[model samples]
Target: MTEYLLYYWPGIPGRGEYVRLVLAEGGADWIDVEREGAPDGEPALSDILSDTSRHHLPFAPPFLKHGEVVLAQTALICDYLGGRLSLAPEGKKDRRFALQLALTIADLVAEAHDIHHPVAAALYYEDQKQAAARAAETFRDTRIPKFLGYFEQVLKANPDSQDWLVGETRSHADLALAHTVDGLTYALPNAMEAALEDHRRVRDLSRRVRALPAIAEYLDSDRRQAFSEHGIFRHYPELDA
Candidate 1:
């Protein structure tokens, strides 16, 4: 059994949370390298990202290292893990559909993050408060509805079951959707409340994901990081309607 090593920021649940959820649910033998400090005292995440010798260098955090393969991008990592952990559908088409849905959720996550840092990721939210407010308005009004509504339709159209996104069994895409909804609920309570009113299936899916045995335990454990200003989903009152 190859042990998985996940490299992510220590505090705040960002893109890494998506990968963590899948690993936890699958009961994979994995270590959060950064969370569990290295002997050198150097930040594990920075060490991996800054390593010039690696042929495939990730430009950011939330990368997974399994044996010699170091994979980047949240959705891509999830897709890879989905295959290894049986969190993906059996057939090729279903697996591809699952990846498609996961990527869509990733897009939504990026948009949500952009709401607070409209000007640039490097710039502080306080510096771009006015721009953030405007960006947030568009996100709450147009983007949330568009993405959430699509998920609702996907659930309805699922030939096997209405609960899971791809097939009868829970996939990585479902976890990603659940996490995205959790973030939205945390950051934009009022906006999410309105958006979910018409999305009963999506709401139910989120509830189901939260109720999973491993997921429930993980959520209650110390490993589950809290939402904060430093994370992708920041609960700024001004940014939220």
Candidate 2:
């Protein structure tokens, strides 16, 4: 068995890709449980989530099962794996700093997803088209600039004066940021094109991450699932403007 078993829905990068990026960079021995497990991925995930016998049951997918540990939420999972895989900075405070950034990135991701499903996640896009368009305008004009610019300033103001997001080296936070940038650019091409022009450091950091040997290889592999309408960063034409 692989050292790590990742439970996430199949067919879309979604929140799971953020976890995947750190795993790729760290070269951790891991497997996508649903993709490699039984054909009914949801049932398998539910089995684990609903396992009352387990003390640590995750409420949703994108959880990782390693040994007797089961971790949910992207930030927590990345923090755990990054530490074990040597992708974390030393010191307690610095690790918390990385988590802080990861949480912010998570906030941005949630907002992006809500753009397409502003009314309700349970409602279809067609049913919420008008609300989504309204939401998209604000997201493209406000939220994107806010989150991306915040990260750019964070890189610029790194006390260590390094290109990485935390301390003097790359941590899980940087990987999360890189994946967030990719998702944003994919979901909002026109807006991101304009937004990225001013956030040069963030853009460069993402580029550097993508150039990492392991990350580049994983990106080129068949395991990499491309962004789609079903995922968080859905690219709706009306929402693109």
**For residues 107-196, could you state the per-residue lDDT of candidate 2 as single tens digits?**
999999999999999999999999999999999998888888889888988898559887988889998888888988898899888888
Worst 10 residues of 1 by lDDT: 36-45
Point out where model 1 deviates above 4 Å: 38-43
Residue 158 of model 1, lDDT score: 95
Question: Relative to the unseen true structure, what is the C-alpha lDDT of residue 74 in candidate 2, on a scale of 0 to 100?
Answer: 94
TM-score for every candidate vs. truth? 0.95, 0.96
Q: Ten residues in a row with the worst lDDT in model 2?
A: 36-45
Each candidate: what lDDT? 0.90, 0.88
lDDT of 1 at 59: 85
